[model samples]
Target: MAERERSVEAMLRQYRELIEAFVQEKISADDFETDYIRTFTNDKCQVPGSEFTVLEKLFFDVDDYVSDPELRDSPEDLSGEQLRERAAATYSKLFGLE
Candidate 1:
């Protein structure tokens, strides 16, 4: 149980770093989305166990954020600014940076 918690915390730290990079414009929205919403989510998104509920939701949000509501019919990606906002928001939520 302790091991699992440590693992989860470690994973969260890695995600925080990635999100910070995106939020800082060190990484492009396209590249960040490719890593975060796609590849990076495959293993962490589900995030079983009730203890990780909020973290799981953040991962899910990132995955689902690929779509823009205004262009629902066409399925457009978010602008760089939008992606940065969300990444910053997610980082705040995940790390209690707010």
Candidate 2:
């Protein structure tokens, strides 16, 4: 039980940090998406208070977020800063951060 609690805490911590970094423009959407997958996708634990378990739901959401063509297009056309801003806004909206 204690071990599970710790894991959940760690997961939430990492999620918050990744969100903060993405919002601050410290990490790109792609980076956040990658890190999120690496951190949570393989965790088979069943988290409560959500429909899809944390791993599966977030993995799919971030994958979709980063995979959008408008978001993933060549940097020359959209620019990194613009892409990051758009991604940040999307993340904020999706997660109710704002």
Candidate 3:
């Protein structure tokens, strides 16, 4: 694979791991979103090949999710739960573990 595809693949794995961490409650919502999710600066999260559309879509979704910043006082509220579900869904699709 080319360097770009490899980079995308690496990012896909990283995203799955991070989303899994968020879903498992091993990390806080703020840590997952503000710190990690917000860092997904990929414009076209995929190259010519490699199945990563879900992760790409998740990147766009993260933009909308964190646009207005639903980060509340606590990461266990409805917003946080919603974020968790979203991340979990992405991880599921990325690995076909749904």
Please list the C-alpha lDDT of all candidates, in the order they appear: 0.64, 0.58, 0.63
* Model 1 agreement with the true structure over 30-89: per-residue lDDT tens digits: 677677755455655344564356555545555555444565343434555765787787
Backbone clashes in model 2, listed as residue pairs:
none
Best by lDDT: 1
Ranking by TM-score: 1, 3, 2
Tell me which residue pairs clash in candidate 1: none
> For model 2, what is the error of residue 25's alpha carbon versus the real structure, in angstroms, after optimal superposition?
1.1
- Number of backbone collisions per candidate, in order? 0, 0, 0
lDDT of model number 2: 0.58
Instruction: State the lDDT of candidate 2 residue by residue for 11-61, as single tens digits.
Output: 455566675677787877768767877766564543553423543554555
lDDT of 2 at 77: 43
Better of 1 and 2 by TM-score: 1
